[model samples]
Target: MPAPPSAAASTTNSTATLDDDEDELNDLRVAIAQLISLPQAGSEVKEKGRAALHGTVEDMRAFLDTGYRLAQAQDDRVALAQLHSKPDTSPELKTAVRAILRTSDPEEMRWFLEVGQYEVDQ
Candidate 1:
């Protein structure tokens, strides 16, 4: 039988980095903290925020489920950047991406933008 991979090779082949998972986990924590900190966020905002937080958690699970090595998932952010840079893109798409890039908090805002469920006021 062929020899097993060397320790160095095996370590290098790990598809997910601890730093990445930690950062995503930290994001979830921050999102949760916001709800606690801002008691006046209102029922509608709270509902949206909770859903967004749930989505972020699910996204992490989905990423882990894919062996964390799928090129497409890794490439999505890059693609988003490329599309945002292209002036020829449709107005609606550009508006949506701009909304996503606006803030790292309130993940629901980004989801709404991505799904075209909410329009960003100029």
Candidate 2:
């Protein structure tokens, strides 16, 4: 059989793993900060990002992987609802918001919130 790894080799591997984990954690922190700073982030995204900032590494990773998108989608839905409910909102904008709400694609909804709405308004 092949020889087992030496203690030095084991320590080096462990140190590398720690370094990787630390790097990932730092990246997550930066992502959360950026998300929180966005004007369109809505309440759910901001709340989730704030929670992730204080949570464990796994929590941070989860936030970046799936939580952020899900939270943003929820916030986007709320925004659409608010737009639809507004008294002075143009028919074109309301129809566009309704169309976005019918679709299941989060990116499409996000796009509508970011760029498509302005196009509709203009």
Indicate which candidate wins on lDDT: 2
lDDT of 1 at 85: 81
Q: How much is 9 displaced in model 1, in angstroms?
A: 5.4
- Please give the range of 10 consecutive residues that has the lowest summed lDDT in model 2: 22-31
Candidate 1 C-alpha RMSD relative to the actual structure: 15.1
| Model 2 TM-score relative to the real fold | 0.80
TM-score of each model, in listed order: 0.32, 0.80
| Candidate 2 per-residue C-alpha lDDT over 1-122 given as tens digits, one digit per residue, 9 for 90 to 100 | 99999999999999999999888778889988998888888899989999999999889889888999999999999988998999999999999899889995899998888889999977
lDDT of each: 0.52, 0.91
Clashes of 2: 0
Error of 2 at 33 (Å): 1.6
lDDT of model 2, residue 12? 100
Q: Ten residues in a row with the worst lDDT in model 1?
A: 67-76
What is the lDDT for 120 in model 2?
A: 90
